[model samples]
Target: MTVTRFAPSPTGYLHVGNLRSALFNWLIARKAGGTFILRLDDTDPERSKEEYVDGIREDLEWLGLTWDREERQSARLDRYADAADQLREMGRFYEAWETPTELDLKRKKLLNMGRPPVYDRAALALSDDEKAALRRNRGTGVWRFKLDQERIEWTDGILGDVSIDAASVSDPVLIRQDGQVLYTLASVVDDTDMGVTDVVRGADHVTNTATQVQMIRALGGHVPDFAHHSLLTGPTGEALSKRLGTLALRDLRARGIEPMAILSLMARIGSADPVELRGSHDELIEGFDISRFGSAPTKFDVEDLVPITASVVHGLDALDVDEALSRAGVPDRLRKPYWSVVRGNTATRAEAGAWWPVFSGHATPEIAEEDREFVVKAFEMLGDPPYADDAWSDWTNAVKAETGRKGRGLFMPLRLAVTGQARGPEMADVMPLLQKKPSFD
Candidate 1:
């Protein structure tokens, strides 16, 4: 069966860039009706944390990408050791006795000579007797894969056929002298062992593919097809990183960002004309298109999120939104207050009353006070009766006469008070809920 995997190192929170790679891999697996695997590359014991590993799984689940199998590199050390031994027996790998300082000097010399500073064949000339002597002396040396000095080529699904000069590439260290497997070897071994057919990840790993392909070939394992998707970029055209202030999935979730909103944002991140996707996760999965991926990097703009946020707020079922607010620790009475404040500022309301007082402490004093007076007088004129056609007309005229404010000024503040935002649906659609005797305090 065709298989794909998202193997992220559990070193930090899941950022947008990592989420995009996972999303793309998920799309490929689903589109092909194949298995999707989730692997944690937790080989670095110091950096990888159980919390981060659990978080990655949660993030993937939130994005609605389910994996068929899960694996951890830390749990499969013996497998990698076996692969290292196999390569050693095939004469495709060797132990290098060069100290760190000596290797650095060699690399510096090569760079000075205008040549790529790689661990060339000079390290491979150690005799069996010399190897034994070094081992006997308790000398610590890394196991390096001896790359074949011929051209290595592969056809990338997205980038097309690409070739690299094997001579220019270094003999990569498979196992560090400390006996820890490096990323390249651990990744390839796991990919092959898991029967992964395609390798889909971010372009940041593009250069590493060459080295991984070489390792796979050395071990007589089938190298999977690759598709290097572009990275998610910030507005400044730089790749998205934590340093750039890209929010983490956990942070976004804490800020009340819906899982669908996050996924919708991720789905449209790299599109030429980014558009939000609505509906259930399954519906999104059915309609996902890899071809829609833009060649240029996607910018993580907060402005790009406004439309989706509005849609989420507007389409939210009243009961669901109320429940969500309640679960979010918003008081039952305060739910409508918050909703009203959000809706009033964005929508056109008949009049605003108690809603105005809620925004009195807000930074926009003039707007808040104006909306408060409107609601008070509108309710006063309505006289506690259920608002009807006549009541609506009376309330409108009363507000115009009493407040002497009209159009945007009369309506905007009320909307702002209810929604706590200045822009959203009109007040006419927003007032009915407040008229039903919702309490803010």
Candidate 2:
């Protein structure tokens, strides 16, 4: 059976960039009736907080990206240790004792000689005595995986055939001096041990994927199919990394962006398909095609979510917005009619709150100077609250006949005077929801 995993470090909130990877993995797994694992890369205990882990779960729940199971690297420390030991016994793992300054100097010297800044494996030349002396002097050095100096190639699920020269790439550090298991080793161990069959992430990990392919083979594990989706950018193609802090999923939810709106756009953004508002997870799953996605940086505009959210809101039934309507203080009796009245005009369910005040007559009226006399006369004919079904038509007809006003000139002012807006639900539908009659006095 097919299996996939989304491993995120529980160090911060999930932004749109993170959402893309999660959504892709989820959709892929769901489409194939496969298992999707939510793995927490919390090896850095100092930075990873339980609150962030909770936030990750909450965000995924909000997006309907339910995982079949969850795994944390913190809980699997012994497994990583075993894997590291196995690589060391195979002569593929070695201790590196270079400080950051020393490594930087070596890289500079290599570049000055027009050579790739790959690690020169200076640690491999050290005798056991020298190694013991260095360990005593500098404490414990980082563990680096030895790459078989050859062309590492794979048929990427999205980027087509990919090839990287292992000779040009430095050996990856699997364990830090602080004894923390880095992502490369932990992910490789987890992916293999947990039976993950596919991996999808951002394009930035392409090189990592290449190195990981070698590491997987060296460890005697099946290398999962890997796809690197393009990174997201601003609307005009500016780098999205700097702006991710503001694009947290919770912030978007607070702004009343619908989950389906976010899901629909993300599933198809860089793909060949045009983004269409999906009403449920089934729709998104049925239409997802990872092969259809392009590798170019996807241009994401937060503004794009507005119209899609409005579309989602417009299709909602009364029960669909029951919570939002109730929070807006729309009584049970008014829920259906109130939604019917404002659903067409709203871009979000929260907008129902704005309309409730208008319907209840607590909103300030917006009458224009030229139409003040006309609006005052119109309201005089409106009488008191608990109006009849035809009350708006009757009152408007009386005002139209008395003033010879018609069309937009007649209806626009009346709407503005009553609801404090030039555009909203039709006056006919809005009339019955009024708790207090309009007063332009």
Candidate 3:
């Protein structure tokens, strides 16, 4: 059976970048009829908060990304400690004492000589007496995983064949001097222990995956299949890292982007398939193929979600928007009628409120300066609202005859005069819903 996990740190709200990983892993697991784990990498108790954990769960629930079980790294600290001891016994983990200043100077010197700034393993040469003295002066030393100097290669699910020279990369720090286990160590331990079969994450983690492959082998564990999907960029191909605050899942939800619209776009934005709005998660799951995705940075624009959202809103059942319609002061009798009349015009369910005021005669008309007189004349010929079902046709016919206007010239101005907008549901459908007469006075 296949197993996958999405490990997110509850330090902040889940953003779009985080969503991609969660979605990919979820699809892979569900598609295989396997288990999906929601692992919280809350090793850093200082930054991680309970509120953020609740927020993460809420966001995933909103997106319909349900997980089978949840795991917290904080609860598995002993497992990480055991793995650290195992690596130490095998001579694969060593203590390193170097301040930030000393490491920066070493890196600068290496770059000046046209060499990679890999760690020189100076700690390996220190004898017991010297190591004791350094530890006494520097406090607790950070634990680093000593990588074997060789080429590490794997066939990535998305990026195809990959290779990295272990000698050129610095040995990863797995445990801090403050006695906190970092993600690098905790993730490997959890993945191995939980029987995870696949790992999917962002393209930025390709190097991390290369190192982790070695770590998994060092611990006598089976390496899962790894894939690195492309990162998202702004509309014009700019980095989205700086503007992530506005791209958070909560922000997008507040902006009225439907869950299906977001999921539909995200599931295929970087893939070979064209993005098509899916009405249900089942449809999205049925169509998902991880192999179809490319490695290039995918361009994402918030504006692209508008049309999709409009389509989603257009197809929404009355029950789906019941609360929103009720809040808009739409009475029980007019809820279905009002939704039907304005559903096409609305890009979001919240936008249905704008039409209630228009229908109830509370909206001010938006006639242009040149068209104001024409609108006043039309209102005179049409009289007050409380219109009949055919009132729009009867009134438009009267105005068209008096002004020698037909087609857009006559209909466009009247729509603006009555609805306060140039476009809306057919005036015929809107006429009977009007509870009060529209007046330009």
The 0-to-1 C-alpha lDDT of every candidate, in the order given, reads 0.70, 0.92, 0.92
TM-score of each: 0.81, 0.96, 0.97
lDDT of 2 by residue, 1-441 (tens): 889999999999999999999999999999999999999999998999999999999999998899999999999999999999999999999998999999999999999999999999999999999999999999999999999999989988889999999999999999999999999999999999999999999999988988899889988999999999999999999999999999999999999999999999999999889999887899999999899989999999998999999999899898988888888888998888888888999889777666888888788899789888888777777778788899888988898999899999999998888889877888898887799876655
- Model 3 weakest lDDT span, ten residues long: 378-387
Instruction: Spell out the clash pairs found in candidate 2.
Output: none
TM-score for predicted model 3 compared with the true structure: 0.97
Candidate with top TM-score is 3
Off by over 4 Å in 3: 369-373, 383-386
Model 2 residue runs over 4 Å out of place are 385-389
Candidate 3 per-residue lDDT over residues 1-441, each given as its tens digit:
899999999999999988999999999999999999999999998999999999999999999999999999999999999999999999999999999899999999999999999999999999999999998999989999999989999999999999999999999999999999999999999999999999999999998998999999999899999999999999999999998988889999999999999999999999999999998999999999999999999999989999999999999877788888888888998898888888888889777677888888887888889888888888778656577889989989989899888998889988887888877789999988988878776
**lDDT of candidate model 2 versus the reference:** 0.92
Ranking by lDDT: 3, 2, 1
The TM-score obtained by model 1 is 0.81
